[model samples]
Target: MRQAHRFGSATIWQRNYYDHIIRNERSLQPMRHYITHNSLTWADGQLHPCNPSKW
Candidate 1:
């Protein structure tokens, strides 16, 4: 049966399949860049739903 989303859904979350530790700023910069870049290029990605969030 289909379930109604009474509380909405997750649009920016992922399963915690793994974990990492950032002991310093240098260790975290790359990850920050990755997320920011992804946001900037999300609309052009083939996996994006609307090529931005969802189609």
Candidate 2:
């Protein structure tokens, strides 16, 4: 964080994060897809300031 501030940059990570446990492959597959495609499927709103249209 200090280095980023010094370089006039910002970090994407927050101070806290959630941790989940995958007991088996079945549960892990969906989460993997969601995480990989979340940004690609973002909706047009305040949360997504770059592109207002869906891909």
Candidate 3:
């Protein structure tokens, strides 16, 4: 976005992002949980390079 252009760095924005319509509340709850908690597990995930065990 504009911040990435202004900073001359897009380390986070370099990844693809997407948006979707929430047709029902039932579907939104899971996405809400994931959005709130996903980052707590990121460092331990295989896709990420910084595993806490290595520290």
Candidate 4:
């Protein structure tokens, strides 16, 4: 999911993820928050009958 968003395409061929370093804790916390909150944030998309809970 993260790869698809960052690279603008899925990496399903590899069946894995790539990572990059975060500069510091200051940069890291909000990213954690977003990841943690993502399910709620995108719930409407999941709720749509055709979308099928991308999470």
Candidate 5:
């Protein structure tokens, strides 16, 4: 908290980071796609700073 206050940010990190569990290939494929394409799809991604769309 001291570092955050020093840097003038309300919080230095999110309350929680996201996680996923892959049990099978069906579930794994999409995760692989997203991880591999995150950079390429940044402009259209849900987490993109400039993107207004929400997942």
Candidate 6:
């Protein structure tokens, strides 16, 4: 957020973030897997602002 401000751009002027709460293992495990592979998955997930492809 501070970086965006320093760049003279509002964070919201760019994109939104996606977050999920820690649930039970069934749910948590998938999120952990996602986090571990975020870079590989970014091209096809909501986490990448430039990627419109769905997860």
Top lDDT: which candidate number?
A: 5
| lDDT (0 to 1) per candidate | 0.72, 0.74, 0.75, 0.71, 0.81, 0.72
In candidate 3 the C-alpha lDDT for residue 34 amounts to 91
Give candidate 1 regions above 4 Å deviation. 1-17, 51-55
Pick by TM-score: 1 or 4, better one: 1
1-55, model 4: which lDDT tens digit per residue? 6756788885445556557578999989988987888866674675555567554
Residue by residue across 1-55, what tens digits does model 1's lDDT show?
1122544654444567567888899999998998899999977877766765443
List candidate 4 stretches off by more than 4 Å.
1-21, 46-55
- RMSD to the true structure for each prediction, in A, is 6.0, 5.8, 5.6, 8.6, 6.0, 6.4
lDDT of 3 by residue, 1-55 (tens): 6766799875764357777788899989989999879988877776575665564
Model with the higher TM-score, candidate 2 or 5:
5
Question: Model 5, stretches more than 4 Å misplaced?
Answer: 1-6, 10-17, 43-55
* Clashing residue pairs in candidate 6 (N, C-alpha, C atoms within 3 angstroms): none
Candidate 3: TM-score?
0.44
lDDT of 4 at 11: 49
Instruction: Score residue 27 of candidate 3 by CA lDDT.
Output: 82
Worst 10 residues of 3 by lDDT: 46-55
lDDT of 6 at 24: 87
**What's the true lDDT of residue 28 in model 5?**
99
**Model 3 alpha-carbon drift over 4 Å, by segment:** 1-21, 52-55
TM-scores of the candidates are: 0.52, 0.42, 0.44, 0.39, 0.44, 0.45
- Cα lDDT for residue 50, model 6? 78
How many residue-pair clashes does candidate 6 contain? Answer: 0
Model 5 TM-score, all chains together? 0.44
lDDT of 5 by residue, 1-55 (tens): 7867998998667788667899999999999898889878888868676876664
Residue 10 lDDT in model 4? 52
